[model samples]
Target: MTARAMTQHTEKLADKWGAHFPAAELEVLAAAGYGARMGFGERPALLVVDVTYSFCGTSPMPVLDAVRANRRSCGAWAWEAVGSMRRLIDAARTAQLPVVYSTMLDPGDAAYEPGLWGAKNARGKEDSPAPAAGPRRDNDVVDDIRPAPGDLVVAKGKPSIFHGTNLLDHLIARGVDSLIICGGTSSGCVYASAVDGFSHNLKVTVVRDACFDRVETPHWASLLDIDMKYGDVIGIDEAVAHLGGLTCRVS
Candidate 1:
């Protein structure tokens, strides 16, 4: 699809979430040299950041209800993104491209605790501990798009996977020169990681359809901002299409 077509993603988000991105400002921003398209690189990896049960909740439901179930829940929006994320993941694996997933360190672990997050989000241990009903941890990646045998799973305490983790080194070792980023909280981790990818001079593409946030406005705004400044925020179809043409960086 065209960039214009891709940009209408915000319009779609506005439809679902209820706030229009000012078209006049969009034009002004574009004229001011934002929103230039930097397509994928020859060797790219699919990066799924924090698609955990804590972000997804127990099942599909509205955000308020989802938060009731799990404070970190993005509600039904998380599940919706999971479907698109799964499709893109399957496409990447079928084409033999590297697929990497990131999750938070287990709650209360020395390596997992961070003061800034704790100060802002006081979600106590009772809320995040492993449930008595099942084997899943609060930080576990949702089972819908579970990491397979060869996929790389990185545990991180920070918003960006590149911070305090070997993700950059892993990408460098794999010869990955670009990234297709997906997964939770559009304004948080996904946005952080995509911009970090760009800062490293790697081509970055965030699959809008495969990412979610608790609410819609920030989700819409973050994607538009990323499209304008950091990277190409395109639809899942375009992301999977690019993944289809790539060769594996490793055997």
Candidate 2:
């Protein structure tokens, strides 16, 4: 098959680091092929996921250099995602759509630490042992985007918002049938949330410009996968426009 005609998963891998993947995901791609054309009804809520320090950049992952490069260097466009997401949040508030913020919560709640990091965690525990002020703080959101009054924040231990969280009930009670998800590490939490949103039958929309990941491969791969299988992947401008129309009707 031609390159564009390549199966979904192959195209996903190829789109990134020229990696190769099986065509098995093509079946899933076919099922979600028309996601862009999917109709989103009234009542949308903004769900921001895992935009925390430990997952974002405070930890030393292989992608940290890429994040730093995107942050303090020439390719800073990636870092602009934070500001873009902020604008989206503002638009959500203006539209009167329910806004939900999701972040990691581990105030002495580190239930899972990799064996490789055991010594580091132990040393840190021995020294101060307490959760640091910024990320571990009970009230802190990310430095980039802060939730204002009336905004709902959901503390989560796992990647999926539905896992060990009251997000589904909150959305259901608020009459929110659609979700606009934005945040860091697009491949992990963002992807997981979108998948769960799909499973729960919510109209899911992911903002391409407003979501960031430390690495490029997984970010792009996850975005394409989500777009092809789970939700509509659009720019923040489109997302805001969609929310704007809804807001005008309700307001």
- By TM-score, the best candidate is 1
Instruction: For residues 151-227, write the lDDT of model 1, one tens digit per residue.
Output: 99999988998998988999999888999999988999999998899999999999999999999888888888888
- Tens-digit per-residue lDDT, 174-243, candidate 2: 9989888988668878899999999999988889888877657788789877876688788888887877
lDDT of 1 at 138: 75
Number of clashing residue pairs in every model?
0, 0
Candidate-wise lDDT, in order? 0.83, 0.68
RMSD of each: 4.5, 6.4
Worst-scoring 10-residue span by lDDT in model 2: 69-78
Model 2 lDDT, full chain set: 0.68
